[model samples]
Target: MKPYNRRLRILCLLLPMLCLSLLRPVPELRADPSAGASTDDREILQNSLSVVEIDREIERITAQQETIQQELNKLSGQLEDKLLQIQDQQSRAGAVIRSYYMGEREGLLVAVLSAKDLGSLIHMYDVYDMIMEHDRTVLDAYQSEYKEIKNTKLAMEKKTADLEEMKSNLIEQRARVSALQQKVDQGIASSSDPEALKKMIEEFTLYWENVGLNEVKTYFNALASAMNDLPEFIQNQDGAIRTNGTTYNIDIKEDDLNAFLRSKNDLFKQFAFHFGEDEITASGQSGTLSLEVQGHYSVEEQPQNSIMFHVDKLVFNGYELPDTTCRQMEEEFDLGFYPQQIVSFVKATEVKSTDKNLHVTLKLSM
Candidate 1:
């Protein structure tokens, strides 16, 4: 073959090989199929599990401590009762001793000498013996009760000490778990592989999304427990819902509302919804009786992407709240109303209510 022809043939072969190389699949860094986890993933999972266990331990210890405290309180009451009984018994004994020293003995002696018959003297002697025995029995009962009270106090002290020690150990375990979590978080953050970091984020996001609704429900349940009743819709904000022949409306911010539903205070920072001229703000506060969420959002400026809730009626403490101004409500009634729960990201076309149930319509941005 001619030299030019030979060179052309060689180029054709080289080009196909280069294309094949480019089309070939790149090697992936993956977890072992048999092991079912990558080293980093396993580490993260283990750290998470450790944290959960530590939290459980802390809760158990706290419960135990509370029980111990209750026992201590009961012991205190018992001790007080015992002390009162001892005081009463001591007073009776002192009175008895005083009577004997101040002339009761002389009187008894004179009565015995002046008795008209042996039978009368015998009867007087019997009365004297019975009185002495009654005083001795009271003193003995007081001493027995005092001993029992002393023992209970000692047991209470020991229980308190044990509870303190348990709490200390739980604290140490929590610190350890926290340290491990920090390490795991740092490892994930410092990862140089973009793909790995992305996977981690996706996993976390999926986990949170799955549990988000339930968390919101739990938060509401907690709120109800704290407040002793759910408040009227008007006390909360502007939204409309109808149930059991009643319509309800309130004003609320979308983000704050979702945060309430998700039971997460942090979600409030993610979105801003203006309700008229005012932007909505949300904050969480704990009172002695309940958790309080406060904020306001304008209805006119409801963002296109925000969630909206409408309710027809709200029932609290077996009474349906009237649709009235907040100022008009009874002073003693506290509307434990807050923005919570994100039901959907899609808007609904129709809203309805039933006799036994309050129907709520949720609107979500497409």
Candidate 2:
């Protein structure tokens, strides 16, 4: 074949391949998950954990303060009731005293001496016994109430002192966490190769895996314990649980969640959760450090109907994490939630978030 003819044939054969390549869709690029582990990676994770753990200690102190406050309130009410009882008992005791000493109501002694027959004497004896019993009962009740008032007042004072101390300690802990967070931020900013370090951090998703999640784990620890002692927040109630035959769905509203959290731990006061368009966003601020996470819930049936909160985005200190980091985070963490952690009466089958609510589907208990 002639050279020109051969070249023309090759071009015709390659033209179809070029056209097909142009028509095919490009695959999305993602972060490399198999990046080799290194010492720097461990340091980043450890730093992240330390910061989060200290922050959680701050939360724990705040929760303890709230508990002390509640106890003091209860003691205050008891003291008030005991004071009223004491006042009423004082009046009763005064009457008994006046009757006993002044002989103002015809003394039992006079009745017995004036008795003219055996029947009259028996009646006098019974009357005296009844008067003595009444006096003794009133005196005993007054003494018991007085003791209770002393105990309640002492407890209230002690709790008040404890609350004040905890409040001071909370301030100190917040300062410490804030300093640690700033140190982490400075280290990231001052790295020799900022982009490379940032890439490594993203590939590992340490911020989501350790920093953001450590707080959530501590919160769940408190919630799991407290819920065991309190009424189930879901089921057998209006606007929360809905049932059809053997299946039920529990709708957990944003307000309801925050309220329950706040009641259990004051750490939730600065943290807020919002539900919007099948997604949940949570943000928390402490001193100069702040973080925000947005995600949606997904169900896993193979693993005992487990529900996971998939992190799609995380913003810390005004920096949005790379998409690669978010994807890695979704694979690694579940935001510390399991249906069994929330309810014991039934098994959860599915979990989905909607605008203003987290809907959980459960099989009715037999």
Candidate 3:
């Protein structure tokens, strides 16, 4: 063979292998069905787990605080009832005293004098002593109940103070956890390489084939068509032909378009393709297209055919797209593709720019 022909054949044989090497799973990407992860990747995962634990702790503390507040409210009501009981007792005592004073000042003496004999006078004196003794017993009971209520109120107030202190401490702890979480997040973000992140995002799309839902399968077919068609439309550069004879231009940078599609592979694995970020610009006669999507696949409890995907950040050309606009586009994409049984879900949360690249963090279900 000619030297030039031999060289060409060797190049052809090696090209596919080179491509395969580029597409093969990296150590960080081997999270599913295997236990191979680098130290940094494991640390990243640990940080994520720690964040979840912290969140759970915060929730538990909050629930406890709510219970304490309810107890305090119940105690307050009891104290009020006790106060009302004391007032009622005082009123009854005052009424009895007033009735006694209102009676004839010499009533007892008169009764004794009018008695038929000494035996009658002694009996009347005994009756008067019994009435005074009954009154004294009622007064003592009222005073004892008042003291008990006061003591109970003091105890309750002390408990409430203690609970308030506990709640304050919990809040401080929550704040500290939140700060740690932020630091971990920043570390992860800073350490991540955009190219690797993009590759991971692309790898995620392969999981769509694992979806068990027939409806989802159909929706994905349509979604794939729509996604693939966008690039074609841009590549054709022949304005989109309208029935009205007007052509709409769609100018898209090919490299950027490929980068955009590659960055969404991981997102597809997570069922969050709708929110994938467009690292390229596909500007046409219509409007610009840019997006950022984040999502995940789970066999756990989740709504069927429902993806919790959010476009947390988006931009079109130099202009930032409003959340509403981003959402509208997402809805339009769904409606335009699978109108019968909607499979994809999207929610736009915010618009922000970051180094003109799509950065995604992989989240694998364990």
Measured by TM-score, the strongest candidate is 2
Report, for every candidate in turn, its global Cα lDDT versus the true structure.
Answer: 0.48, 0.68, 0.47
lDDT of 1 at 283: 30
Ranking by TM-score: 2, 1, 3
Q: Show model 1 residue runs off by greater than 4 Å.
A: 1-35, 96-118, 192-366
State the RMSD for candidate 1: 23.7
For all predicted structures, in order, the TM-scores are: 0.39, 0.43, 0.36
**Higher-lDDT candidate among 1 and 2?**
2
Clashing pairs in 2: none
Model 1 score (lDDT): 0.48
Task: Give the 10-residue window scoring lowest on summed lDDT in candidate 3.
Answer: 335-344
Model 1 residue 34 CA deviation in Å: 10
| Cα lDDT tens digits for candidate 3, 125-177 | 78777877777877886888789798878878887887888688677767767
Instruction: Give the higher-lDDT candidate: 2 or 3.
Output: 2
Error of 1 at 4 (Å): 83
Per-residue lDDT, model 1, residue 89, is 72
